[model samples]
Structures are given as C-alpha cells and as structure tokens.
Target chain A: MRSAFEWVDALPSSIALRESLNAYPTLLTTHVVSMCLFAGLIAFWDMRLVGLTLRKVPVSNIPTRLFPWALTGYGINLITGGLLLYSQPMRYYDNFYFWAKMALMAVAGFNMLWFHYATYKSVQAWDQGREIPMSARLAGVVSLVLWAGVVVTGRMMAYAGLMPEWWNNLNIGA
Target chain B: MTQSFFEWMQGLSFSAWMLEETWASPIIQCMHLLALVAFAGAVLVVDMRLLGRGLIKTSTARLARELDRWMIWSFVALFVTGAPQVLSTALKQYYSPFFWWKMQIIVIGLVFTFTIRRRVAFAEEGTLGHWPKVVGVLSIGIWTSVSVWARLIGLLS
Candidate 1:
C-alpha cells in the first residue's frame, strides 16, 4: 500500500500539481464548491427522510428529483478529490484524519445502500405520511452524523498535530 | 479609521483566545462548512427548480418557501462562525484583498438572492417565460462566485 502511494506520488502530474503556483488552489476551490452542492442536497434529502423538512413534497419525488444533481456534485468531488490525492498521496496516507474521513465515507456509503435496499424498498407504503418508519429515520440520522463526521475529519486533516496525545499515539502512521 | 477598528478588534481578548486556542479556529471552521452545506444546498434546490432541471413536479414557489427557513438559518450560522475567523485575524483580513473582495461579493449575493431571485422564484408558473431560467443562471453565478472568493481568501492569503 505504501509503495503504491509512493509510485503515484512520483508521477509527473502529481509533481506538476504540487509545484504549480495556481493549479492546486484551483483544484481545492473546485472541490469545496462541489462539496456545498453535494453535501447540501444530501443533507436536505436526509432531513426529509427524518421528517424534519420538505414535508409538503412527496417522498418519492424527493430522491427522484434531487439524486441526479447530488450525483453530479459527487462526480465533481470524486475527480477533484482524486487529483488532490494524486498531488499529495503520502501526506493523506499518513494523516490520521484522512483515514478517519475515508472510513466515515465508507460507512456513509453502506448506510445509503442499506437505506436503498431495505428501508427504501417500502417507501411507497409511507411516502405521503409525515412520519416515516423507524428504519428509514434511523438511516437518515446515521447518514447525517456520518457525513458531518466526514466533514470534520476532512477539515482536521490539516490540523493533525493539534489532536490530543492519545489520538496521535493511536495513529499507526505516527 | 477602518484600520484602527480592525486593529482594535484583533486586540480584543476574544480575538486573542480564538487565535491562541489551538482547537477554536478549526472547530469554528467546521461549523462554517456545515452551514455552507445547508445554505448552498438550499440555494441549489431552488435555483435548480427555476432552471427547470429537478423537482419538476413541485412548484417553484413552494420549494423556495419551504427552503427559506433553512437558507436563513444557515446564513446566520455562516455569519456567526465567519465573524470569529475574521476577528481572530482582523488585521490580516484588513490587508488581504481577497477578504475584502469576498465581503463585497457576499453583500451583492445576498441582495440579489433576496430581491431578483426571490421575485422570480415566487412568480406565477408559466407567467414569466424565460425570466426564471435567466434568474436561475444569475443566482447560481453570484453564489458560486461568493464561494469561490471565500475559498480564495484562504488560498491566496
């Protein structure tokens, strides 16, 4: 794994991105802009699932309408995020917060899958009701928490040293 | 006078604490980002609808009305979290051209959103013709610029 990261780190594109005066920041700005669109759509969708907001809109319409835009946002982030990783693979590879963010994202993905396959299968049964079933609501809560975690950890990747001694001690990379 | 005011702000105990405390800035930044997610998401939902892209079944007025609350709250959160960030480094902010540009753009973005954007969004369906699409494009452009400028403040600084 370390060697694979090392190999990517040595690529000409990575070297150029890291060395370029303007490209890195441009990439980062694009990443953040996309984040607002992606995470924002997902948050509202989750809020709807939890019966917090968008009560007037039918449940079936929410995902069908919003998912496309959300996916577009996700696609932009994936490309930018990949380039960012490409620019500095080892830095992220060694960063505890980065690993934590990846783990949180994985869990968020699984939660989405669970909601789609399990709870969402019966969405028609209660699509119009103000109160969704417990399973779907739980999925919303879990996704909200996990995505928020992802954001926090993503931000903290820049401030890894500020983490407590225990956290640093637990970081295998350290 | 403006520079002195910024200097005074930086000299405050609260500002000192915000800068001196290791975790304070990052925590506030996290809140700002979270608020950004909510705020931007709300904006996108309405703008997209106006563009005739998504949520085609729901009326634009209803979507805007439903999302207004989230938008306002998230904007408040962004302001609250953002103030400390500026205050903590108030003097630096005063010197940073990008910071000033961001503030100016934010003001423009806010006014445009509440005025022209709001009127278009709430207009009777099919009454405005291409106006909704133009407003949608303009709204997206203004808000995206605000975000871009905000990011540049840190990156350029």
Candidate 2:
C-alpha cells in the first residue's frame, strides 16, 4: 500500500503540479468555487426537506430542480479533488483530516441512500403543504451536518496541520 | 489614512482577544462559512427561478417575495460575522490585494442583488423581455465572483 502511494506521488503529472507555483492555488480556489455550488445547493435543499426554509415549495420539486447544479458542482470537485490528491498523494494518504472527510462523506452517502429508498418513496403524499415525516427530517439534518463536517475537516487539513509528520516524500520532485 | 485605521483596529481589546484565543478564529470561520451557505443558497435559488430554470412552480414575484426575508436575514448574518473577522486581521488584510478585491466585489454584488435582481424578480412575467434574462445571467456571474474572491482571501493571505 505504501509503495503504491509512493508510486503515484512520484508520477510525472504529480511532479509537474507540485513544481508549478500557481497550480495548487488555482486548484484550491476552484475547489472552493465548486463547494459554493455543491454544498451551497445541498444545504438549501436539505433545509427545505427539514422544513426550515422554502416551506411553501413542495419537497419533491427541489431534488428535480437542484440536482443538476449539485451534480455539476460535485463533478467539478471530483476532478479538482483528484488532481489535488495526485499532487500530494502521500500527504493526503496519511492525513487524519482527510480520513475524517472520507468518513463524513460515507455517512452522507448512506444518508442520501436511506432518504431515497425509505423516506422519499412517500414524498408525494407529504411533499406539499404538509409536515415532513420525522424520519425524512432526520435524514435532512444528518446530510447537512455531515456535509458541514466534510467542509470543516477539509479546511482544517491545512490550518490544523492535521497532515501526518511521518508522511515524508510529500514533495516527490524533491 | 487606511493604515492608521487598521493600526487602531489592531490595537482594540476585542481584536487582541480574537487574535489571542486559539478557538476564536476557527469558530468565527465556521460562522462565516455558514452564513455563506445560507446567503448563497437563497440567492442561487431565486436566480435560477428568474432564469426560468428552477423547479419552483410559483410565480416569480411570489417566489421572490417568499425568499426575500431569508436572503436578507442571511445577508445580515454575513455582514455581522464578516466585519469582525476582517477587523481582527485588519493590518494583514489592509495590504492584501485579495482582501481589497473581495471587498470591492462584495459591495458590487450587494448593489446588484438589491437593484437589478430585485427589480427583475418583481417584474411582470411576460413583460420583462430580455432585461431579466440579462440580469439573471449577470447575477449568477457576479455572485460566483463574490464567493470565489471571498474564499481566496484566506488562501492569498
């Protein structure tokens, strides 16, 4: 596993990104732009689901409306995030904050699944001008919390120095 | 001059405390982010509706009226939290080009939001012609700049 990490870290693309002064900053800023779209829309939809906002709007309409924007944002993040990892594979591989972000994302994924399979099946009945089932509300709350956790941990990876000290070879070019 | 103002702000007791406390910065950062999510989310939804791309099956006027309160509230929250955060690092941000850029865009964004976007939202549906579409597209572009530049402030600093 360590050898595979080292190999990717040593890849030419990774080396190029690491060497370029503008590459990381540009990528980081783009990642943030995606976050404003992805997480921002998700937060809005989740709030509506939880009956905190857009109370007059039907619940079923939100997913259909916001899904595309959300998907675009998510897609951009996936590309940018992959490049970011490529640039510093070992640093992320050993970072506790990265693992925490992964864990939170998994939880959010499961919550989304449960909402679709279980709660969303009956969305039409309670979709408009009605109280959302506590179960669905729970899912919404969970999604919001977990996504916020992902953002916080993602930011802390830099400031908190949550990167592992033992993850040497961060600079493959060096 | 701006230098003396920033220097005075940096000497404030509140600013000193905010700087000294390890958790204050992060907590304030969280508040700033939450406000961003709320403000941007509400704004984007309305903009999508104005652009005729949203699932909101209501009249544009009604949708705008309904969302206006939440948007205003979030904007207030953003300003309240953002002011102190900037003031806490006044000296540093005074010289940071990104900081100035972010501030300029933020003011421009506020004007666009209140003037053009608000007008189009309340305009009669079919009567709007091409101006609403222009405002809708511009709103999205301008807000994107606001969010991007706002996030870049920390990165550049």
Candidate 3:
C-alpha cells in the first residue's frame, strides 16, 4: 500500500492536478452553485409537504414538477465530484471519513429512490388539492427525519476530517 | 442507531483528518449546505401550516406527515456525508459544547414531534392548537440553531 502511494504520488497527472489550482477549485465552485440550485427547489418541495407555503399548489405537483430541476443539482454535484476524485484518488482510500461520506450519500440516494416508489407511487389518488391521505403524511414525517439525518452526518464529516492517522492506527480495532 | 454509531466512530485514527483536503470534500460541503435549505424549508412549511400560515384548510396531520419525508431525507444526506468529516476531526469537536447542544436540541425537537403526533393521531383537518404550535416553534428554533452551529463547526475547524 505504501509502495502504491509512492507510485500514485509520482504519477504525472496527479502531480499536475495537485500542483494546479484550476482543476479542483473550478469544480468546487460549480459544486457550490449546483448545490444552491438543487437545495432551493428541494426546500420548496419539502415545505409544501409540510404544508407551509404554496398551499394553492397541490402536494403532488410540487415534488413532481419541481423535482426535475432540483434533481439537476444532484447531477451537477456528481459531475463536479467525479472530476475532483479523479484528480486525487488515494487521499480517501484509507481515509475513513471520506468513506463515511460516501456511505451517507449512498443511503440518501437509496432513500430518495425508495421514497419515489413507496410514497409518491400512489400519490395521485389523494393528491386532489386538499384530501391528502394519512399514509402520505406519515411518509412525509419519515422522509423529513431521514433528510435531516443526512445533513447532520454530512457536516460531521467535515468535523471528522480533523483526525490524521486513524485508519492505520486502528486497522486492528475491529 | 445512527447517532450511536456516530459517537462510537469518534475514537478512530487521527489520519481521518484528511477529509478537509479530499477532492470530493467541497462538493459534500455544498451538499451539507443544501441539506439545511431543504430541512429549513420543510420545517418552516410545517410551522407555517401549524400556525395556519399555509394549507389553511388542509389536515394538519396530512401536511405535517407529508413534511416528514423531506426532514428524514435531509438528515440522511447530512449523516452520510457528514460522518467522514466527524471522523476526520473527532478530537476537535468531541468536547465542543455546540456538539452536545445540537444533540440535546435534536432530542427535544424529536420529543415534541412525537407528542404532536400522538395527540393528533386521529386528527382531521383544522388549524393546530397551542401545544402543537409551540412544538412547531421549538422545531424551527432547534433546527435553525443546529444549522447555525453546524456552520460554526466548519469555521472553527
């Protein structure tokens, strides 16, 4: 593994990306912009689910129509994220925090997909402006909890990054 | 279960700190911010609904429950991406009161949520009463504080 690091460290492209400011930062900027786009739409939909604003808008219409653009934020994030990873692969291989972030993202993605099928699948039946069902409401509650958890864990990821030599030191812990 | 796991993982290696420099770090940070928008927007919608802000004639239960989905999703997003960050800087934030405070607020907020659900389990469409309104306020306060502190975690680090 150490030898692999040496090889990786010596790679021409990695060296260039590591040295250049343009590669990662440019992508980082996009990541920020995309996030704004995505978060803005999702927040609106979530609020609708909570019955806060746009009461005139059907519950189903908010997520259904607004989702397309909000989802674009996720796509932008993925594209920008992939580029950054390509620039330096090994930094996160042994880094548990990085892996944890990946794990949370996986869960978030799975949850959203599950939600699309589980909650929204039959939504049209009761989405007639004001007669939304109890089941759908309960699903909304569950969805809110899960989403908040994802956000907290994501921030905690940044906090966790302060650890410097944890993985190798505790490779035998479990 | 998720909360417990986060605590247990705190004792890992110091090397976990590299997350601040990773290629995907910035992207995740952006997502973290995005989670706030989603959660806040969701919660505010709930609050306004409870206070008769929106969905004036909609069932409080349905609106509240529907909002639940976004809240859960937001948290999930934060956790999945945030854990790595915690592992990286465990020691720095381990004793930080903001960390503990965030947890406490979450617990309180959750309890309020449960109580609201319990009392209004069979509730039909109408404006929420005083208690649920208080809970709604608490929810907004605690969650907003949590977000603010979370941002602080980044700055302090």
Candidate 4:
C-alpha cells in the first residue's frame, strides 16, 4: 500500500505553479540574497538582546525598525526555498540531512515569534530604553545558536546524500 | 603573473603538504564555515544600527564606531584564513565560477563599506540620521549576497 508520503511524492507539479525554478540562475541568485538578508537582520536583534551596542536604543524601536525589513527577508526566503523544494521534491524528501535542516529552521522561526511576544515585548515596556532583562538575553542566545545551526545544517545537507555504492560521490566537488 | 606567484606558493613544501592531507581539507572547510557566521553575525548588528533601525539610543556614529572595533577583526580573521587557502588552490579556484563571482561581490562590498564609512564617520551629529540607515540597508544587502553565494558554491558545485 502506498503511504500518504508516497502519494505526495508521486504527485506531479502543476503547470501554472511557477514551473519549479525555470530560471535556475535567477532562483539561485534570489535564494542567496534572501539567506544573507536573514543573517543581517537577526544579528541586529540578537546583539541588542545580548546587551551590545543597541543597549542605548529604545527597546520598542528595535521591533518597529527591523521587523519590516526582517519580514521582507523572510518573504524572500520563503519564496526561494519553496521553489527549490518543489523543483526537486524527491531528492530532498528522502534525504535525512534535508529534514534535519528543515527541523532546525522551523524551530528557529517558531522560537523567534514566541520570544517576541513572550519576552521582548515585556522587556521593552518595563525597561523602556535600558538594557534588556535576563529572559531576553537567554532567548537571544538560543535564537542565535538555533539560527546558526540552521545555516550550518543547511550547508552540510548539500554534501550529504545517500546513494548506492556504484553511484557515490555526492560530496565530491567537480 | 598571478598564476606564477600562486604556483610558486603552491610549490612550497608546506603548501603542497597542506593540500595533500585528507583531514586538512575538512578542517579548512569547517573553518571557512565558522568565519562565515562570525563575519555575517557581527556585520549584521552594525548594519542594523547604521540603518537606524533605532537599534541604539546612542548616535549612529557611536554605534558605527563600536561596530568598527569588532568588525575589523572578524573580517581580518576571515580574510587571513581564507586568502592562503585560495592562494594554495588558485589555479583550480580561478577556474571556478563560484570563486570569481564571490570575489567580485567581496571586492565590491568592501569598497562600498569603506566609502560610506569615511563619510559616515565625519558627518555632523544629526546629519547622520538618514545616511547611516542607508549604509545599514546596503551593507545587509551586499553582505547577504556574498554569504549566500558562498553557500550556493557548495550546493551548485
């Protein structure tokens, strides 16, 4: 019996659905730009929460200032990443490394939203422009580490793919 | 000229031996990865501030100066480690589309950072408000492209 996962795997992409990365160069370019975008925004937020230079800036402005751009970055990542996955569903689906990277990315994103509401908001209200509380610090550290893991795992995934003995060299460079 | 110099470097005993070691490749590769995170992380914070994301209550100049302190070393580490490896593999890497594109981005990005910084440092107090933000946005955009392209070099190659 074919499993639900099998059915999804067997399903063909719809013709009108952006054709799963027709412009390889463009899609590739977009993906890289988007990845870096996240790196840029996250570092800003993380440093502030850690009592770095942003300490002087009003806590409330941090969200107002960076959030819009951060959202733009997330949107870019979502579009590019979704396209890449759709283009090669089977290769990524069976790959363990791909799943691990995806898991880390999900955790990073979820924790970010949770941290924003649960912690950063309160700190901003109570402390005003002062150094953030300990809770924000801990959350920031976890967020930074988790995002770092997501990037590292994502890179590692490129070199990891299971294949038969005769068909090896997934990790080998040209 | 560049080829000969690189070849001369490659001919050295230590350089040849460095490349020959199985473990060295992985170690260097991993170091490259670490450098990526460090450089990106540090710069992003500063870039956010420069863009006047209202990250710091202090003046943009002060925040930029603080970032100036840390960013130099982070990049120093990245360039210091990355350069020799590239020198060792120049011929091979030169042929790589990835290497060429990355070099272009890095050179342009560095120049961009330097030009804006000179102006930003000297700008009168309140005048910095809008300009710093511009630098912040540009830095993030360019650096992100550099790092992301570097990753693509992994997947595409």
> Among these predicted structures, which one has the highest DockQ?
1
DockQ values per model: 0.86, 0.59, 0.10, 0.33
Please write out the lDDT profile of model 4 over residues B23-82, one tens digit for every residue.
Answer: 554456555655565566567656665665535565656666666655777688778767
lDDT of 2 by residue, B39-92 (tens): 777877888887788755877787788778878998899888888887798988
Candidate with best TM-score: 1
Candidate numbers, best lDDT first, in rank order: 1, 2, 4, 3
Candidate 1 segments exceeding 4 Å error: none
Model 4 misplaced regions, further than 4 Å: A1-22, A129-131, A161-174, B8-58, B84-89, B97-101, B125-157
Question: What DockQ would candidate 2 receive versus the native complex?
Answer: 0.59
Which numbered prediction scores highest in lDDT against the true structure? Answer: 1
* Per-residue lDDT over A11-47 for candidate 1, one digit per residue giving the tens place of the 0 to 100 score: 9989999999998889999999988888999999999
Find the number of clashing residue pairs for candidate 2. 0
Colliding pairs, model 1:
none
Any runs in candidate 2 off by more than 4 Å, and if so which?
Answer: A162-174
Worst 10 residues of 2 chain A by lDDT: A165-174
**lDDT by residue for model 3 over A1-174, one digit each (tens)?**
545655776688878877786666566556545554465556566545665555656666556445665677779978876666556666544556556667766775676677678877877776667655665655555555555555444444444445447565775222
Number of clashing residue pairs, candidate 4: 6
- Candidate 2, residue A89: the lDDT equals 86
Model 1, global lDDT: 0.90
